[model samples]
Target: MEWNISGQDFVTFSRFVGAALAMGLAAIGSAMGIGLAATGALKSMVRQPERQGEFVRTMFISQAVAESTAIYGLVVAMLLLFTTGGGHTDGIHGSDWVNGLRFLAAGLTMGLGAIGAGYGIGIAGTHAIEAITQRPEMSGVFMRTMFLGMAITESPAIYALVISMILIFVMGAPDAVGVFSGNIMDIARYVGAGLAMGAGAIGAAIGIGTAAAKALVAIARQPAKQGPLVRTMFLSMAITESPAIYALVVSSILIFVFTPTDAEAARIFGGMDLVAIGKYMGGAIAIGFGTIGAGIGLGIAGGGALDGISRNPRKESSLVRTMFLSMAITESPAIYALVISLILLFVFAVPDTMSWAQGWAELAKLLGGGIAIGLGTIGAGAGVGIAGLGGLIGISRRPQKEGAMLRTMFIGMGVTESPTIYALVVSLILLFVASSDVSTMSQGLHDFARFLGAGFAMGAGAIGPGLGIGLATRDALTSMAKQPAHEGALVRTMFLGMAVTESTAIYALVVSLILLFAVG
Candidate 1:
């Protein structure tokens, strides 16, 4: 153990690990995307046995586009393997751990970023094939839509790639340049940035693809309305992209703004500024995990609007109005996440004086609040989408009662959002009220547990009821559409069901409050 740094080429070893992660994770999404393309194309060929060649051609094209993200990852892996950009040229030393983690973060960023984009492109291809099968004459329009959707879906992956390349070619830690470089805090920020970009890409890409897929179907159903449909699709996808944008913003802030200068790293060795660590880490987690559900929800709502438009083209204006409303509400959870992230990043500062244990307590508090809002909103966002889509479908069928149907939709979404609201409350308490100045290690640890326990207790608690309430209200809206004469009965019954479904979120809030206020 006391031997010199001659035991292992740690730098090379770390690069190899990074290479493995980049290619290995990228392979999964690309393979699945390719498989999805093949699956859909094959099914379409079977249905229209004579058009196999055309289907195969489009399938290959889609597969090719989907493969690009993996290709990007491959290039990153190769660079890491050969140490192409730059690295410790001297024989690998033990102090290369910071550089090692930086490269690891790079791989993770590219690998995770490719997943949703690849799969989403494949989804677009699948639906594109279906559109071709249904309306062979307008294959060109469908292809265009498919490609456009795929391109937009790839945006998040592109962001990830940029960050990955930056990590490889520009930034470093072992050969410390920034104040924060080569420190624990720098490592946390780098890793958090990776996660923020990578995971944030998932829901947004899928949502955009969902919209594209449905728009293709709508075009096939109503070619005369293609112009309107395409416009709606563009608007929907634009909004859906914001979640990834929020993640990107957080990633950029972490990488570019809050770095440690070389002087700072030299002066302070292992001074655990837990607040700064929490700021980067917690903010990343908030935007990264929080945007996922909202993006999916927005996509679902958008897709439903396309479906409704195709079904009742005569009511396009009304349906589009409803679509806008639905999307706005569905996107709120991501907004909440962005707000929390901004607050964490800009509002909190490392205290001037504190015990080391007190720092840990602060770290836990920030993380808990971030986790609370991040995970809590997922189910609520998706649930609201479910309800919104159901209401849209119902309105398409019964436009005469649009007013009543929309009222129900509003109530449903309002209730669906309660869980997120509850989580927000807990997060605020942690941010503003939770104690982090305890001098004793025991009290500090206690505060840490209390903060995290409340964060998790409420965040995880609100998820199920949010989705459950949304589903129940969806059916209620549909049922009302079917039997408008019995609207009274349906509305009352839906209220009761949703209230019961919401009880679980209430229980979670109670537990969170108890953790925050009653825990020793």
Candidate 2:
């Protein structure tokens, strides 16, 4: 049998997919979290029969908070399914494809936003149970801490809901015009905006989960020190959550603030408007992927530090200070990525009169900048996590060498960050540098070269540092394990090795910049 599909039909199909994804994924996550919390609460109740009412109440409250994300998703999905109607006509600027794309993005925004929240709520809820079971008297303090962490974790989901709302009610509205009108580029912008918050939220969830889990463990271990530990965790979580906020800001700007050129100009550019779409997409990916690593890295570092403090409560002050410093260092790459993304979003411009090749070149630069910074930071984040993990291990083994191990870890992490710096420089050059005078096809080719080169420079540059830092950390841990007394010498040697390993990434960065500006 043969099958036929019209544009209108495809648009309808897109709406269905969007509605399904938004509701399905969100509900799944919420169910999982609620189930997890309910099960934990039951177990806790069994353990503390007298405090059953308190356990049940806490679980219900946490589950309700978790369910809010699903509700946001459902509301968005329902709006997309019922509120919009029909498809684009030939004469209308809006196309069915554009409408479909908008719904697709809306679905992704809500769906992905719920994923992290679910995992986070589960982690937090499980810990809440443990906290209550361990010390029912401190249930009030534990609940407050859990609620705070869950609230922070839900911020990304809220951001996604906001973006979805804008896309459905504002941008995709049938009567909308100007930037909000559903043009190809505008649709791309909406999609990018959705992705920015959705993907960015993943890291925030993990970070919050890590902090929550550690906080629970700490509270159980030292109920008397709950105040200081909870405060520190919340502070760390605030920093960890900053990248998501940055992504949200960027997504909002892309959705509501970015003004595309006039419809006539768009008509003239025709398909070449893809260059504009590419720019927004690149910005989204840059922030999304860039922040994920930072989130996970902060979680690892913070969680490890909390574990250390719990194990060795006397060193609380030192461990907390070092964790803050390590988390800040780990966060630097994401911050750099945010800067690059902003430059791509706000600084780069393509004239309507420019040849298609020039537009393509501009798009290439935007995409290359995004990839360079985004991928570069992933490696940096991993390196920082590894270095922090090693430092934590070393400290746990020999608390006396906490100072030495932290110093060494910082030096190594700084070296690991070199590639991100190089990536940033190349991204800036790509964003700001103009293409040389050349034929249309040649300029396009040159731009493509810059695009690939920037990505290669940053990606390849990052490899050495990531591996070098991991190796340095591994050996440092080994050395510390074998010769705790000689930690000072081991740290010095590890730093030297990491510095040497990092040089290769610098060379790659130099090559990338050369490719970006000096070549073609």
Best by TM-score: 1
Model 1 bad stretches (over 4 Å): 1-13, 84-95, 174-182, 261-263, 269-272
For residues 1-520, what per-residue lDDT tens digits would candidate 2 score against the true structure? 8555555676778888998989887887677888888988888878879988888888889899888879988898888889654764433335566778788889888988787777777778877887878987777888888888888877777888888887777775333322222265677788899888888887777677778877887788787777778777877788778878888888888888875555532353342565676678889988977887787678777777777777677888777777878888888888888988887777766445456666666667778778878777877875786677677766765787766677777777777777777777777666666454444777677777777677757765785586467658756865785698787788778778877888888788778767766765
lDDT of every model, 2 decimals: 0.84, 0.75
**What's the lDDT for candidate 1?**
0.84
Please give the lDDT score at residue 48 for candidate 2.
Answer: 78
Weakest ten-residue segment in model 2 by summed lDDT: 173-182
Per-residue error (Å), model 1, residue 311: 1.3
